[model samples]
Each structure stands twice: as C-alpha cells, then as structure tokens.
Target: MIPYVREIQFEYGACDQVSPLIRRVVANNPGPFTYLGTGTYIIGKGEVAVIDPGPDMPDHLEALLAALEGETVTHILVTHHHTDHSPLARPLQEKTGAKIYGCAVGAKAGDSAVITEAGHDLDFSPDIDICGGGAVFEGPGWTLEAIATPGHTSNHICFALKEENALFSGDHIMGWSTTVVSPPDGDMTAYMDSLDKVKARGFDILWPTHGPPVRDVAPFIEAYIAHRRAREAQVLKALADGHGRIKDMIPTLYAEVDKRLWPAAARSVLGHMIDLVRRGIVVTDAPEPGLDSDYRLAG
Candidate 1:
C-alpha cells in the first residue's frame, strides 16, 4: 500500500496512543529521506521502552516527555545510528536516565568519502551494544526480540515486539519510499541478503521509523525483493547496453525520477555496480567501484 501524506492522519507533537502498550510521537523532521516524519515509539506503560527517539529537536522531546508524564522510560532503543533516528537518544537518556541500546560495532563502510553528516550520526554510541546475537530485552509488560537485519546500514536492526506480534522495522523496510542503498556504508549485497533474512521471520506487522505501518508484511517483502531484483536487472541491462558510468546509468535507469534525487540515485547505482563486481557478474576499471568508475559485464 502506498503511504501518501493524506492517508497518514496523525498530527505533529500529539502522542496518539496506538495500542494498550505502545504510544507514537512523530518528529517534525520531514524530508525526502524522512517521509512525513520520524516515528518515535514508546512501547509499554508505567515502565516503557522508547524506540527511535527521532532527531535532536526540543519540540519532539517535549512531546515524548509529555506523553510519558506519569510513566518512566526504562530503555531507549535505537534501530540505527542515522542522524534522524539516533541523535535524540542521548538527550532522552540524560533526561530519563534510561539505558541506551543499539548496534554499536557496525560493518565499516569502504570509505567515508560518500558519507554525509546529515545522514550519519557519528556521535551516537549506545551504552549497551546489542549486536551479533539475537538478544531479547524483557521489561515490565513487554519483550523486544532484537533481530539483526542489517541492510540500509551495516549496524541496522529490526525489533519484534512479543506483546504485539509486530516488528519495529526501522528504515530497513518502509511503505513510504523504497529504502535507499547508498554506498560506502550501503552494501547492495548485504541489503538483498537482509531482505531475505527479514522475509524468513514472517512478522504479522512492520512499523517503520518513517511512514505508515505495513500490515501485509509477506507480500510487502516479496514486493521489496522483487523491486530490488528489478533494479538489479536494469543495472545489468544498462551495462549490457554499454552505459558504463553511474551518472549515465542514473539518467538511463531513473529517467522519470526527480532531478534532485539523481545524486542519491547515482549512489544507489554505484551500490549495485559494486555488488555486481563482487559477484563477478560485472567488472570495474577501478580497484573499488565508484560514481565515476566504468563498469562492464564480466568476461
């Protein structure tokens, strides 16, 4: 289902109680990446666990604090270290004295050349690094099963709520827009693998960090996998048609796409090219494939 702004009827700063245990406070940091806004969820009542505190904005924090007027924030769980998702965790931790948990040790990007500060929150380091194993965090009335579904970023994760039969999918899967797999941190191979990983779990619902909830997760995952596969096919066809550079491929593959989003599209194209190079399906002139690097079908 398409996540149009008109369909999402929630107002900013209002703590809409979605469930008996979960309350959502969406941040007003809407952008191309953050469709509508960042959804900061407070799971459980009395002693609750805050998921994705959203961007470091005073208003958003006030809204969260207001929502938890009589409640205590026990755990502040972050899905990833993206600026829009994790920066507010520190401030919330300072205020509520809640322990911060997230993927601390991430798979290193090839290089930080393509990385932007606006996207990555470099200062974010969790008190408890919940990576590697499938760690289950239990509390007063809730249990969050941490599943490491790294794709959008190396440290990316999705948490399944035992109480609700749902997964806080973070930015790994969103109904608003297709997850952007931009390198050097964004690996196309890892992303596709993670999609398969998430699909296998088969959760009842997926509440993304941005946009509306995905109720039909199985079909959605299938569609996601199919979309990526189609993009990969397009990249292959572009290579076959002798469009070597990522810039050329962007125009050819994403002709109908917005001009402003083409740079991001180029990065995604580079991601696909690098993945193809790794698979020996495509070869590049440079040792590491880049935006300017030339690519071709493997001999």
Candidate 2:
C-alpha cells in the first residue's frame, strides 16, 4: 500500500462537519522514493488555499483542478520549497491565478531539487513574499500565519490557522516516519528549536503535509523530542564504541536505515555530530566537508 493514498478524515473548525481536505492526486516520486505527500485543500468561506501541491505531474494538477472544480483558490501556500511540495506551486498558480506564498525560493542540500526523480520543477515564484517569520494572509473567514520553521530547510515555513486552532506542519512534524534532517540546508539545532517553538504555542491539531493529521499535539511533540534525543544518544554511543568516522558508524549505528537513504541518514548523523562537538560531547579535528568526519567522545 502506498503511503499517501490512505484516506484520512478530520473535523473542520469547531463545527461537527467533517471534511476530507487531503486527497492523493498522484502517486510515486522518482529516485528511491518511499512515499508521495498528500495535496491538502483548505476550504474557506469564498476563497480556498492548497498547501504543498505535490509535484508538477499533469495528472496530479488535473486532479487538483477536479477537486476544486467549483471553488476559487485565493492562495497557494507552500510549506517549504522542497520539490515534492513546492514544484507544483508555479503551475498551480498559473492555472488558478492565485498568489503563491512560502518562506523563500531556493534549493537546499539533500533535497530533491538537484535530483529530478520525484517530478519536474514547475519553477513557480510567488507573487507576494512571505519569507521572514510572521507574514500573514487573511481570507474571508480564515487567516494563515506563516511561522518561520527553519531547520528542515533554511527557508522552511509552517502555516497556522488562527481561527481553527490548527497548523499546517509541513515536514516538520509528520504522522508517519521521522523527517530526514539533511544538513547544509537542514540544521538539527534549528529543527529542535522549531519543535520547541510550536510546542510553546499549543495548537490543537496538526495538518501535516504528509501522512495523517496529528490530533494530539502535546504527546506527539514529546515523542518527537524524545526520538531526537535517543538518536543523539545513539550517535554518542557510536563514538564511544571506537567508531572514528561516519562511514565506520553507519552499519553499526544506523544498520536498519534503508540503503538508498543512507546518504540522507549520514547527513543527519553529521548534523548531530556537529551539535555534539559544540556541546563538548564529541571532539572533531575540524568540520567535515562531506559526510566522512573523524569524531570521538569528549573526555
């Protein structure tokens, strides 16, 4: 079974009306793709917003149009500039003439930008800029506050629906597997800080760009926090076990990680190692250029 095809239903707003906002328009991403993200529909009074238009596939775009047959799209909000999520921004904006909004325009390391496996780039640029934190858009009855959630990407942003008490989490907090923290673009410290920031706000629901919606925010945040700490601990252990380099630690520390995704995993480990070095938990001669870096537990 494909990851995004699964149907998820959530009650919209404070009303008893349940709306099926997310529907899988297209499946399969190029490269060693394990899952395709769900295209989200935010239905409002007279206007609508589509979040993370997945890829630029014709069928997917057509499906999106079909889904919003009788509706008017006021804005196309991108959670992040990732290919799987933001590639369709341009094409969708062209089709609907809606303003595209996101953190910024650029590609990040370990992202699908360089690799065209997932889908072709739509090369869309938003009419209005919402990059810096606190940029907001107010619709008829709904308003979206673009919260700067950097770490996953330098320009990554998440949308918060003030009226609904909900948040469009993007890849920051997913219902499925843990998000890949690939660095150069992705920073572990920033990611951890973003999580804490969201937790402080206390949202009621999380409408992630992928997988199912997170109904409970507190416990979910706690688990995610714990998971990262545990991974950091594992990294420390790997260093103590005489694993001098990332390559040496891969098989022993991240043995269960997918072979195809090892590169991404290694980047994440490197990010953690960087953090450990800053805290004196680990010592590195110098910042590793790539993934190969000699590291040892601090005395």
Candidate 3:
C-alpha cells in the first residue's frame, strides 16, 4: 500500500491555517476525484503567495479574497493547467493584481482520455514559466522553488517551500490517491523519473492540493515507486498470460477499483504500455500505442 492519507477536517469556503505560514481554503466542489475539494493554499503573511488557485467558483474566489483581507497577494502560483487547479488564476489575478507564475499553457492530450474531475484548461497561460531560469519565487517570509514534475500533464510543476522544508506537491504525488497518468500528455516514463527527482529532494512534508499533508516522506515515496513497479510486473504477467489489450487486462489488474474509474484506469494502463513499448519490452500493433492497442512481449 502507498500509505494514503484520506482524512481531512475542513469546511467549504473556510480558510483555515494548517501551519504557521500556510492557510488552506477548500473549494465547495467535491466529488470522487477531488475528495473534499481543491485545497487552495495561501503561503506567507503580509505579502503572501497563493498556490493552486483552484476551480473558478465565485464563492471560492470570494472566500480566498476574504481570507487575505489585510494581506497583499504578491504572487499567485499555479501547479498545473488542470481545470480544478488553475482556472481561478485569471479571476484571482484580476482582483489582486498579482502576477501569475507556474507552468505554461498545456498541450492537448489524446481525446480518448477524459479527466473526470475537471479537464485541462488550455487557456490558462501563466505570466512566467517558472521552469525556466532559477525557478524560484520569494514572498515576504517564504521562498518557493518550482520543481518541474511533468507526468500527470506535460506541464505539471511542484513548488517547494524552502523555509519550511516542505513541497506543495500538486497532482504529481497526491496523498489521497495514485496520480492519473493519461496519455499522450501523461507519460509514465517521465512520471517515474519525476518521482525519483522528488524522492531525492527529501522534503519533510508534502502538502498535496487535493488532500491532507503527507508527513511520512521517505517511506511513502518508496511505497509509491514500489506500487508502480508492481503494477508494471502485473502488466508483464498479464501480457505473458495472453492478455494483450488494455481493456482485457483491466478487470484483473484493477479488480478492486470501482467500475466508474475503469476508464481512467485504462488510460493509466495505456501510459504504462507506451513506456513498455518504448523500452522494447513490448510491441504494439497500432500505429501508436493507445488504449485500444494490442500488445505482446518482445521475442
């Protein structure tokens, strides 16, 4: 198991200070994917920085503005271009006159993958691509180092708070659930590499956007990587046993998973197959390996 953290105590549109410098305001939007909702983070005190402005709900925006009644929002930092994560950035920026900083506009993923909670927002263009240059953002009392962790999307970026030795891990590494790596934007190979990059950073805590903090950093990450490796092993085993298509492997591979999430699971499996095909461990019959592609082990 990945030691998933599912419990969180918070009210909708209420900004609660979870740490000395971090105040989180949960959006009213809730579902199977979003857990309680998108937790928009406010970092620092006087001149604050906001991470993951979340969905474009008017009430959520009002609550955010209310939370920073006296403070100046100098920077609005986004994690990725997912509709749940970055759609409010534009409206928030208009209200506070804060410069938006984070990943660039997202490239279109394949049409087959439907990101259930909120789809990608192609219109979300940041003022600064933090991945370029030094990738550092500083506020009154905090400094955030942007770590490019593309996998969930080609443009995903996680921010590390240097003052607290914590990372505001976006959708890259959630504490609640395993990240959805759908293609062609979601690359399993890049996702695995990013996991290694984060593990090497050795942060004390990870405050994911969707759920509560991950306190046990090292072991949790190890389990996460191990879980993926195990999934790969299972995929190979399935391929060896005559399960050559993603749809065929789904029932056994994700037997415990809810049927509703099977489509999402299929997309993830496709990501793995794409990686496997690239490494020459498997061969695909389709022009490009996709959800419907047939696969077999290399001779």
Looking at model 2, residue 101 earns an lDDT score of 82
**Per-model C-alpha lDDT, please?**
0.84, 0.69, 0.89
How many Å off is the CA of 270 in candidate 1? Answer: 1.3
Q: Write the per-residue lDDT of candidate 1 for residues 1-299, one digit (tens) a residue.
A: 33322246689999888777778899998887787899999898788999999899999999999998888888899998888999999999888999999988454643566564337887789999887638888879899988887768888878899878899999899977778787878778989998898889878888899988888888888888888889899999988888877787777788876676777778888888888898899997797788888889999
Ranking by lDDT: 3, 1, 2
Give TM per candidate.
0.94, 0.84, 0.97
Off by over 4 Å in 1: 1-6, 105-112, 116-118
Segments in model 3 whose C-alpha atoms lie over 4 Å from true places: 110-115
lDDT of 3 by residue, 1-299 (tens): 88999899999988999998899999988776677799999999989999999999999999999999988999999988888999999999999999999878554643535555568877888998875424888878789888889888888889999989999998889898888898888889999999999999999999999989999999999999999999999999999999998999999999988787788889899889999999999998789997777899999
Query: Best to worst by TM-score, what's the order?
Result: 3, 1, 2
Off by over 4 Å in 2: 1-36, 106-124, 287-289
Models, CA RMSD each? 2.0, 4.9, 1.3
Query: Residue 286 error for model 2, in Å?
Result: 3.0
